[model samples]
Target: MTVKEGMGEEPERYRVEFASGTAASVAKRRSFRDLERNDIERDLPGWPAQPPFKVRGFFGKLGVHVLSATTGLLMLPLYILAEALGSPASPEKRGELEERENEIDDFPVMWAGEGETARTLPWQLDPSRRSWRTVTEIELAEQDGLVRIWSYEDTGRGSRHLSWGGGEKVPGSEAVLWSMPRSEITSAEIKRFSMAESDFTVSFRDGSWARLTSSPHGARRIVALLGQGVPEGCHPA
Candidate 1:
C-alpha cells in the first residue's frame, strides 16, 4: 500500500553513525543573534539624569578653589630646595667661587670643593684693618726631580696664594704642588713625569682649560686656568 498523490515526499529520515559505538542524537539548533541585538532596547529601562555638579552652596566652590591654590603655592619652596640640592654645580656658582680664590707665584694652594664652591682654610683677613704690616712667602723645592714640600704659614693677610720656583728655603713658608680644584679636576693619573705629560689638563668653570705637564709647568698651567687675578675668568665650566 503506497500512497504518493497529496504528499510531496516522505519527511527525510537520519541515522546516527559512531566510530566507537558511542550513542549520538540530533542536537537542538539555537541562535541568539536577533535577541542579543534587541535585548538592551527591549528589556532594560532608561536611567534618569544625574546632577550636573556637586550639590553645594556658592561658598563651597570658592573654598575649594582657594584651597587648591594655597596648596600649590606651599609646595614651590620645597621643590626649589630639592632641585638645588640634587643638582651638582652650575657655571654661575662655580664662577663665583673661583673669583673668590686667589693664586700666587710662590706657594701651593689647597682647596676643598663644596657643591660648585671651593673652601679654603685660615680665611683671609682685611689688610687695611691690620695695624702691623706682614708679608707672606711660599717656597717649593726639587726633590728627586719631583716637586714636594711641607705647608707652612707666614705673617701676612689671610690671603691665599699659589707658589712654585724660589731660590732659598724660607722658615715661615712651605713647598706645595699646585693642584686643580677637586670639583673641576676630572681625573688624576700617575704617569711618567716626561712621557705622558700632555695627559694632564686643568679645567675652569667658564668652559676654559689649560694643558698641563707633570713638571712644574703643570702647576703653573693650573694656576692660570683658575684665573687667580682675573675677576671675570673665574666662571665654572
Candidate 2:
C-alpha cells in the first residue's frame, strides 16, 4: 500500500506482540494526516481484548476500606444528636410533670351541666354562656338536727365551697360501692344522713345532688369538669 504524509509519500510499518509471544508486522503506505485523523490503535470488533484496569495494592486497598468505615461511624453520632435534639420530651421530663401534678393539693372543682337532668341541677350555672356571672353563696346551718344546704361560688382559691341539705332524712342503706384515695375527691359536698346505726356522711355532686357511689361516676364528673373548654370531650352523650 502507498501512504502520504504532509504532501509526501511514506511507508508506515508497525509491530505488535501477543501474550503467547507471537508477533506480527503490518506494512502500508498511507498519508500521516489520515492516520492522525482516524483512530487506528483500537482493537477491531470480535477481538477478545478488554481495556486494562489499574489496581492499587495492599495499603491503598486498606486506606479505602478505613475511609468508608470512618465515614459511617462519624455519621452515626450526628444522627443520634439530631434525634435527641428533636425529641419533644424525654421520659424523665414526663415523669417529673406527673409528680408535680400529684403533689398539687389545690385543684379547682369545675363541672358542666349538659345532660338529661342538667336543667334540674343547682349549678346549671353556665359561667361561660352568661353575660354576667352570678355567684350564689349559701351557708348550711344545722340546728336541732335540722340540716340546711346552700350553694356558694366563693371561698377563695383552694377552699371548698360545698353544701347538701334536703331536710333531715333517714340515711339510705349503707352500700360501700367504691372507695378512692382522698386525693381523688376533687370537689366534695358532704351530707350527714341519719343512719339507723349512726350519722353517715355522703359525698355527691353539687349540681344534681346525686350521690356518687362509684369510681366511674367520679371519673365521669372529673371528665366533665376538665373537658369543658375542649369541644370534643365536653359534649354530653
Candidate 3:
C-alpha cells in the first residue's frame, strides 16, 4: 500500500492505494489542518441526515433545559453555604489564574516528516507530583527507518501573540528527549507503578531501558512500532 498527501485550493486530501487495485481517499476540513494528518486512518462514514423536526422534539429539549436550570438553582444555596463554611476556599487570585492559563497555552505541536505518522499523547511523568501532567510525542516511518520521540515540558516558553487577532502561539524547542534505532530493541512492555504513573518501557540488547507514559492510542502505536523490531533504549534505565 502507498499513501500520498498534498495541499490544494480545497481542504488537504490524502489518497491511499493498495497493490490489489483498491483505493481510498480522505479529505479533512480546512479548519482541522492542525490535527494529525494520519487520523484519516480511523475515519468512518458520516451519520445519516437528521429526521424531520417535530413539536414533541422541541418540547423534549425545552423540558430538559428547564429541569437543568431548576436543579442548578436548587443547588445554589448549598453551594453558597459550603463556601461560607470555608469548605472550598475563596476564588483564586488573578495572577494565579493567569499563571495556570500560561502553563496550558505552552503545549507543543509534534510534526513528522513526509510519509511518517506521528501523535502526541497525554502523559504524566510523575503521578505523585502535584503539578499538571506532561505529553509525549512520537513519530515513525518505516520507509525512512526512523523512530523519533520527544517529551515536551509541561510549561513552555512564554506565549507569542499573533497579529490580526490570530490568537497566541507557543514555540517549543526541537529537542529530542530520547531516540534509538529500531533494530536495537530486544523487548518492550508497559510498567505500572503503584504511586508513579504507568509507562511504556523498551529494553535494549545492551541492557539499557527507556520509559515513557502515553495515552492508550499512543501506547498501541508504540507497541506496533516495537513489533517491527525497531532499535530502542536511548537512555540508561
- State residue 34's C-alpha deviation in candidate 1, in Å: 78
N/CA/C clash count, model 3? 6
- Tens-digit lDDT track of model 2 for 34-135: 111221112222222333222335675566667656866876777677678995421111012111111121111122233312122232122222112123
Model number with the top lDDT: 3
Q: What's the true lDDT of residue 232 in model 3?
A: 38
The better-scoring model by TM-score among 2 and 3 is 3
TM-score, prediction 2: 0.17
Clashes of each: 10, 5, 6
* lDDT to native, each model: 0.26, 0.24, 0.33
Q: What ranking emerges by TM-score with the best candidate at the front?
A: 3, 1, 2
The estimated TM-scores of all candidates read 0.17, 0.17, 0.32
lDDT of 1 by residue, 1-237 (tens): 112223453221111000010001101110001111111111112322222212224575466557656966786777677778995432111011111111111111222232221221111111121222222111222122221212334444434333332324347454342323334433222112212222233333433332222233443443433233323333222
- Candidate 1 vs candidate 3: the TM-score winner is 3
Clashing pairs in 1: 95-235, 104-162, 106-163, 107-162, 107-163, 205-235, 205-236, 205-237, 206-235, 206-236
